[model samples]
Target: MTLRLGYGTNGLTDLRLDDALGLLADLGYDGVGLTLDHMHLDPLAPDLGARTRQVARRLAGLGLGVTVETGARYVLDPRRKHGPSLLDPDPDGRAARTALLVRAVEVAADLGAHAVHCFSGITPPDTAPDTAWQRLTGALAPVLEAADRAGVPLAVEPEPGHLLSALADFHHLRTLLGDPEPLGLTLDIGHCQCLEPASPADCVKEAGPWLRHVQIEDMRRGVHEHLPFGDGEIDFPPVLEALASTGYDGLTVVELPRHSHAGPELARTSLDFLRRAAATTNGAAPC
Candidate 1:
């Protein structure tokens, strides 16, 4: 029951994409959470298919798996962080976000990624709850279709301060979309500690079936900041134990998008921390 660990490329923003991948590989990580940002893969860049193919080859050479992530704050609109979300009232605004997810599906398929990660944005102040739900479902439908065609799961994360920001909200979304096969969950361990009524381990156990991707970090019970392992309050041993118990085989990526200044050091220490945690779980494989 090895809980494979990887680091998010968003945290390695200071390095070139190739250099980031190489560093993770050299550190003995199993994979990477490759965010499609302007500095990285750039989903909106020209000759994207060619670029994706090149990245795919690089990943294969490095023996590192990948999960495509669409969480770049300003990729879609430079002025607005995470702008033009799926629940936007304007049709075109919603379409832009949907298109990005669809493109993510294509990239995921090309890269043989286990899942494509994304999130529901903050609800507009003027939007009604029902209307926002409607917009979210409508916008995600086509992206789900594209994922279905590409044979890639669209792993929607429950982001704090966003419209769909809880495990229950993820269930509601699954039901709303009629439980499409390609739709899955990106369970973030820190987010559970931040806001969930259940403990993070319990949340991992419960989300086992729908979970296709995962993000890990340390955080306090109420605050939303992503912190290094020992800096926060999460009891990681039980969390890793529950993750292994669930038989989830996807990469549980280290998510530290703001710590690029120490990305290389964090990446190394994070792998060591998680390896030690995994070792504490019975029948766990060694690093």
Candidate 2:
């Protein structure tokens, strides 16, 4: 009854991609949340298929699973952070983002990744709520089609301050998309702690059926910041128990994108913390 834990590569920006993967493998992590970025696999790079094949081999050799993450801050737009979102007012801007996500689905298939993680970006200013919803639904349609074709689940995350900021918003999206099979949820534990009315453990239980990917970190209520273990108000043991009970087989990835300066050290310590927490959970041992 253990959860397979992994770490996100976005937190290891300072290390080479090879070194980062090797480091996680050596640390006994079961998988990785691989963010497609300029430094790590570079989704837009030339010969992307060859690069993806090489990474597939690396993960296979290391016995590590993967989930392709599409939250690279500047992969598409150099000047804007997470710009050209699904809800962008400009049609071309939204298409660019959709194309990137489609490419991500291809990469995920090649890597044999568990899922492809994404988010509906922040709602554009001066936009009506209904219009924003229309833009998002329109934008994600092709990406979902790509996921269906690739046999990969698209795990859309509910990011704080974004268009889809909560669990209800995700349900709204599901309803809008007509409950597509390839559509699934990436539930962030910290997000629950930060904004959800229910406890994080309860959120896990409620989201179980739709869960495809899970990102975890310690965070205080009402704050969106991602914190290391023991630095926030989350009670992790119950959350782990709930997660294990859900029968979700995907990686519960440690997401610390801003902690790359100390990525290796945090990777080691974070695993230790999760293992200890899992040990306390009703015999749900962590690997």
Error of 2 at 72 (Å): 0.5
Model 1 TM-score on a 0 to 1 scale: 0.99
Which sections of candidate 1 miss by over 4 Å? Answer: none
Residue 162's lDDT in candidate 1: 92
Worst 10 residues of 2 by lDDT: 278-287
Residue-wise lDDT of candidate 1 within 16-69, one digit each (tens)?
A: 999999999999999999999999899999989999999999999999999999
Clashes of 1: 0
Candidate 2 Cα deviation (angstroms), residue 73: 0.4
Query: Candidate 2 on 211-273: residue-level lDDT in tens?
Result: 999999999999999999999999999999999889998999999999999999999999999
Candidate 1 has its poorest 10 consecutive residues by lDDT at: 278-287
Q: Best by lDDT, which number?
A: 2
